[model samples]
Target: MWLMWIYRILILNHEISMASIEPIILGLEGTAHTAGVAVIKGREVIVNESATYFPPQGGIHPREAAIFLAKEFPILIDKVFKRLPFKIDKIDGIAFSQGPGLGPCLRTTATVARAISLRLNIPLLGVNHCIAHVELGRTVTPVDDPLVLYVSGGNTQLITFLNGRYRVLGETLDIAIGNALDTLGREMNLPHPGGPHIEKQAQSGNKLLTLPYTIKGMSFSFSGMVTAAKKLLHDHSIPDVCYSFQEYTFAILAEATERALSCTKKPSVLLTGGVAANAHLQTIIQKVAQEQDTSFQAVPRNLAGDNGVMIAFAGTHLFNTGKILSVEDSQVKPRWRTDQVQVGWIE
Candidate 1:
């Protein structure tokens, strides 16, 4: 009878220990051309894997990209599971990028997330893609509260956290900075993603040609600059045009960021998103941070781009804060703005 009592005690302790373990979340990202999957145990990222679809000729065709994500997501998810120390059933919740992204791509990812959540009988979290970027930047960097400069193919905004949500102080009035770069890249016959190539050519460019500098209040427009830069290509070398393009655009961004920092008095400035990979942008923003007497941080190149890890981290926050959603309510938002999300976990 004493042996039986000891066995029961041991079993009870094991159950309690299991219950005390931190929750694990699986995240999926398929907002555009990239399909990603990652696993996070509490705040630690266990595995992150992704595959990007490159258009054969021009920009991403939404349907084609969706098909690619549909095919690649399973493979990436399997890869993540293989690298994980625990089994698939051990996942406590599922999180996915809900929006704002291509409709087909968002649907594909949401379907996968729903399937996983239902199969495992776990909570489902629909995370905002833009908020995920900011959250991940905060998690990996030393910044507590920051003035965020979010730049990417589809978005360009100067954001700050206030009250219960991220507020946009400034944003692009026309095309996003990354899209403008890619458009210019298409004009130059460069690859689909034009930012890196433009940066490369800008290194050798000596001439700073004329380009429109549009800044109305806190918002800026890149479409005019892009058009003018394209026109300059006929009379100037690619390198010179690229150089002038970076100088003008990055300067505009730095100016806006500085203004926001000064106005908000944020202790730090964080640069994040796909365009955050540009060294020139980083340099310019760093300078602005120094001038404002605030610390500066840029998302690491690997995490700067869209990935599943950010989504997972954001999802973990949502799950911990009781933000789980039912499958029926987990719908995609193609035009979800940055300020639309209620950032309940920040406070």
Candidate 2:
């Protein structure tokens, strides 16, 4: 009991000190198709701008997306500076998404971050992309400690903070939920970022065709569902397939989330990442939270998808904790896992 009391006191002190000082940080995020730049003075986002690359056909091509990000980053940075009332030199640090992303994209963004860090003679902080999503969700919402449902294009996991780290309680065994949706969308001749398109079609769909619902313990798999959905195209209506795809996949996610919540018993549940913007998934997870009698909040639509603001916010926390990185040591990790990062900024 004494140890717990001391820990709470330390956390309170940290919060107070952080609230007293507002440091300016410039953050860059180019993990995949989006190239984003933003500046933040503490929690207030000064300017956040991003450009997404949409292939003419098919999913993201790493080389092509890297080229697109490299081209747009300068413009986005310029836009951010122009929108700021103060000079760019006021920034105290530069933060970039270090990894768990495509190699080319991560390198492109890291190069820009390093250049700016050296140019300004400021500290550089490498942030984990997955942790940034959870931090961003926490920043924009009222939930202090919550079970995080991070669903995106390349990754899906249920995360919660414990032992000074974000622990993964559950994750996808095969392709991520977003990837499955996009793949099915492509097979249907839909445009890129199939989540929105699928959601639209699913609204008109009254029937739910059977699709694979693979969940073992806390982990789930979407590969089977994607394959089955594609074959269902031959005999089933597009709306029905889309609706069924969402129902089965989202139900699997909701069940897993609920199970983790039951075990962790976090105060709330946070639905983040690009796929979190889907209303159907939000509804399903919200219902789960309701049944558990816990609060639920989804990241705002503006911050739901990948953005530089998340990097800046999380970077600010890391910077305050003195987790600076040297240019020579700022190498990107394509397979960096969330559990590998120590949450020094948090308890």
Candidate 3:
């Protein structure tokens, strides 16, 4: 009893009171391509977490993704808080990507976020995952009212938001650019993750090989390009084919983005997604934007990849806009639309 009293006294003496936190936000990302989580104190991100799960086959497996998240979620969050380099008590709220992604994967992320919010007794905010990427990329860029072109493993398209609604200016009529690159890489017996490998090989490649550079009006098609490139492999070097393919496909994207700027009367362009890490793609887009006399915005290489920081940043934006999600709003919809967001996001 004497020892227990002494321990209690020490604990009480060490306990410190905290001030009211000024809206620290946490963001959850478990969409189609990457599973991640992030913590933000106002505009600055304290901790951003992400993990990659590559399937044995070509694409993502929902069941396997859920299993990976179940294990990684707690560890990542613990690592975040433990290594926070700042006060943990200042975290004010929670934010998460609510929809338009894989159902099983999103459920795993949402379950974790909901539990965290309950434990902290903080408000939970729902953010659109795509919009978060756009906002974060824009914040880091010098573009103002720019036409945005977002291309990733799961998404590929041209977009412009007008009057708080994101309008699809043009998009892939078939497979996404990354999807096509991955398929081509698999055919060439490359690694599981194909984008970087293909980009590396393209450096030595010549544009002698011919690939289908299909562009129909504002929309584009990469399926035909993948097929054509595979056929050329028998006659041309892999590097040559890869180079030609990059040139052909990125040209489509650049042309579409440029056209969007002209139509919207905006001389700025923002690029995001995993594919944005490609130096060739960035150079091409920069050249196009420069030729058109428009501003170009591409997030840093670290930020471009799917990470928790973007999610947390996105969630904080939602919280400030009064877009909180209720306890009953836990349903995970895999195919949520971007324009379906009714809340006032941008002015």
The models' CA-based lDDT, in order, is 0.92, 0.93, 0.78
Between candidates 1 and 3, the one scoring higher on lDDT is: 1
TM-score of each: 0.95, 0.94, 0.89
**CA shift at 33, candidate 1, in angstroms?**
0.7
Q: Worst 10-residue stretch by lDDT in candidate 1?
A: 15-24
Model 2: per-residue lDDT, tens digit, 235-297?
A: 989999998999999999999999999999898999999999998899899999999999999
Q: Which candidate is the best by TM-score?
A: 1
The predicted structure with the larger TM-score, 1 or 2, is: 1
lDDT of 1 by residue, 74-102 (tens): 88887888989977888888999999999
lDDT of 1 at 337: 90
